[model samples]
Target chain A: MSLAPSERPGTHPDDSNLSATYALVLVVEVIVILGLYWIGRQFG
Target chain B: MQWIDWAIVAVYLFWIVWTGLRMGRKTEELESYFLANRSLPWWAVGLSVMATQLSAITLVGTTGQGYNAGLSFIQFYFGLPLAMIILSLTVVPLFRRANIYTAYEYLERRFDSKTRLFTSLLFLLSRAMATGVVIAAPSVILSVIFGWNLTLTILAFGIPTIFYTMKGGVQAVTWADVKQMVVIVGGLSAAAVALIMGLPDDVTVGAALRTAGAVGKMQALDFTFDTSTTYTFWSGLIGGLFLSMSYFGCDQSQVQRYLTAKSVDEARGSLLMSAFWKIPLQVLVLMVGVLMFVFFLFNQGPILFKNTYLPAVQSSTRAAEYAGLDREYAQAFENRKLAARAMAAAQADGAPAGAASFARSEFVRNDTAVREVRAKATALVKDVTGDPDYNDTNYVFPTFVTEHLPVGLVGLIIAAIFAAAMSTIAAELSSLATSSVIDIYRRHLKPEADDAHYVTVSKWATLFWGLFACFVATFAAEMGSLIEAVNVLGSYFYGSILGVFILALGVKRANGDGAFVGLIAGMSAVWWVDQHTATVYLWLNVVGAVVVTVVGTIVSLLTGGATAGPDAGKSAATRAA
Candidate 1:
């Protein structure tokens, strides 16, 4: 029997939102780096 | 420092210690002392996470990096947000669910006791030494600004921290960290505002940044794939990722922060908070450095940012030569100032990027001349002082704060520096004590000790590490740039430790034997790579982690891997491994 993701955390078998959150973080990082690159190109 | 400034600093110091002592009253038991009985709020834990990682070096050393090298250093943390996200998914939940005091405890349960002892011992060594560098960063730099003796300053920073952390425990340290984190952000915000305000009347913020861009201070990203380059998009994204994983996932100092949260989700929540804010916060920090560069472009910045060496140079035989360089520096400063103003004017007049190219090149050229003059003066100081390794990078921000900011603000920024140093020292001290008592003292020295006895041992452990860190600080002050000094020290050990955790969690056929041998191999490989190649320090983390996983796996397969016990290889994510 697997422990419920809410009460007991384990392998990310139940929560797809957690993956979304991780993906969101990566997306945000990409955007931030792109923004920084733009700043360099604009002025640097 | 003005009387009001001193008053503000004095009040801040006294208030923090008093608050820490009061909150630490409930830490009578081992769990409560070390983990606050796992009852802390996510926001508070989140703030504590930031407080521990963002040290005095962030203020004193990173700002100098911004001023000296520009935004290139920002790439070093490019992997941080992702690392936090990955950790929230893995260790934040794993360590919390496992109900472990130290991350190493899980290693023993998953692998063997030897792996647990060895990993924890490595943490104790790495963190204790890194803590000393953290303590050294602010005290040595601030001593010059405050004109206080280095030893006294080290004490002033270390003792209050040691006293409260010893008595109040992690609970006290965490609560104090929340308040200190606020002061740090507030001070940085204030410094940012004052820096913009200090720009010359003719130079707008946009104009100033454009001028900064001309000299490459505004460039925040480099696409270079060179392994020799320290901070690049690739190095930061890949190399920094491994380093961050090792630090937050495997290192006890960070694991302990999230473990204080009420549940697994809350622990992940705390790390997510860092994920969202860490990069933007770093941007603000580097911008402050860049703005200081712009601020100095028009204003008359000293030839030497450090005032401490002035006396020695004045008394030496090269004093006359130093005076001549000083005169040349003034002219170079004027040339650079005029070029900066012209660049700003061109931007204000709506010149296109292509049209303003000449002005930018002129500014860059003049800036180089200014650097040459300053370098000559610095050599004179080094020659006369007989301190061949003298560096003024850490002094740049502190000296600027004292020399430039309004009176009360100076005190606030200094207090922020104090906050940065004390918060880190408190966390490390508290974590050091936890690892010592939980892993070594109780586990080995006296396996049957009660809570009260262990708590007493923990306090003495905190005291011992505190004084040891203070002693290390005196010598660590001159190793190099305080920021890089701490990170380089960590990079040497962080990757290998992370590799061990990977073996236990991800590699199913890996046993304690594999983990142990893999750890030694990883560390030795990191050392070998560092000695043999110019592959930059960030990439060393990658080398260490990869080498360990590969070596551990081969050994584990050869030894027929441990597949017997119910708890064997039972990691949080792969519980049946």
Candidate 2:
């Protein structure tokens, strides 16, 4: 018998919504890293 | 170390082991043992995911990388968040819907048992070999710091980790990992803060950064189109993406982490957690090392951080020569300190660009002379020890921890190091046992075993792999060349393994025969590139996955596609004859 998926704590949104959010998250992170790089270059 | 520090470490170990054992008491079936009944919350699994990736070497070594070479090393993780998003959309839901115990089990449903067994064996072999290095790495620090026997050190780390993982299974491993993540992060955060506060009064935070920036330590981006550079933006994004994809998508250790989450959404959330926090976390750890670099400028830093060869240098025929070099190093260090102070003052004044520029060049000249003296000392020590590549990057953080950090904090950081080591080893041991049972024993050795029987066998598998890791680690201490060979050989297989997964997921035309052949071709291509070209190692993953998919798809098309749908073969039930 397959173990049933337990009820989630409702903390996370659905996968479709979360997937898009994560994609956005990655884009934001890349920007942050780039910002850090530019700032480091300026101070450097 | 002080008694207070020893007390903190001892208490932490006791609590961690007890908590792990307590969590495992209810794990009576394979589902509970391996997947935590798919009932774990997203946050627990998320922290475990982070903890598993933040191994001891990463904690110590990456910080050392920050100290030695600036934040350019952070680029190595540029692909990680992207990889996580891809896995979230693709493999996370795919594995959840299939309801498989191991990732290779899904390969069997899509391909054939031979494909399943071949890939699983690769996982077992590579992971088992890598686990040895994982345990050996921190044990080296313990041995040096505590003056303990290396074999005993191996056992000290391996034995408790083995027992808890063997008894508690994934539940124990996951919970222990969550707690470990806390300690690891807390210790690192505390260390970073302390290092900043510990800096001399004259060197303001901005000044320290300017000092670091002036030395090219803070330069994080390199936009050069050169393929030969190790940590370029392109290499990190492309190469790191491929490596992260294979690791998160295909490798059972990581696959198993997300699989334990309550639902596909939670699994994706766990990975997303890593994606969001990983770069910033890396920057913080690297910042600690950068701050340490500034701390050493004003303080009298060691000429050679690894002091193992001090007695030998003092007693050797070249003792006076070493002493003269030490005196020269002191003079250069003082000159560099004055130059650094001048540069910091000039930068604050907004004076003509040439003043700061001159101070920077003067500081650099003195710094280069000091490094030259240290290089000569390193060579002399290497000659005395007869180990050619005796660099001390790994020793730098531990040396700093002992010498500088306050008493209770030192113990806390040391415990965090142990936590990092245990968390990784636990996850590895858990996944190794899972693959061994789900992919091999149940599929081949005994397909009809009852739940109790399989669970018992799973425990035995965990114990066996744990012992095996310890065995390899013991020998690894004696044979350095073998460890290198094992690491190189492991890298050779990852791209091929990742390739087969890509075929399984993306290429509908791929049959068992095509995938099997494509895997071999991919391995061959990677080996060929490694032997013939100067292509950086990160690119090998991309090449391997692409070669497998292209070759496998071509072969499948040439052989005529889709004779059957999903149930392509049932010979997986039969043993190889």
Top-lDDT candidate index:
1
Q: What interface Cα RMSD is found for model 2?
A: 8.3
Q: What's the C-alpha lDDT at position B50 in model 2?
A: 88
DockQ of each: 0.38, 0.24
Tell me the tens digit of each residue's lDDT in model 1 across B377-469.
Answer: 888888888777777777778878988999899999989999989999999999999898888887678978678888898999999999999
Residue B258, candidate 1: alpha-carbon lDDT: 90
Error of 2 at B305 (Å): 1.9
lDDT of each: 0.85, 0.83
Using all chains and alpha carbons, the TM-scores for the candidates as numbered come to: 0.94, 0.94
RMSD of each: 3.3, 4.1
Task: Quote the positional error of residue B3 for candidate 2 in Å.
Answer: 0.9
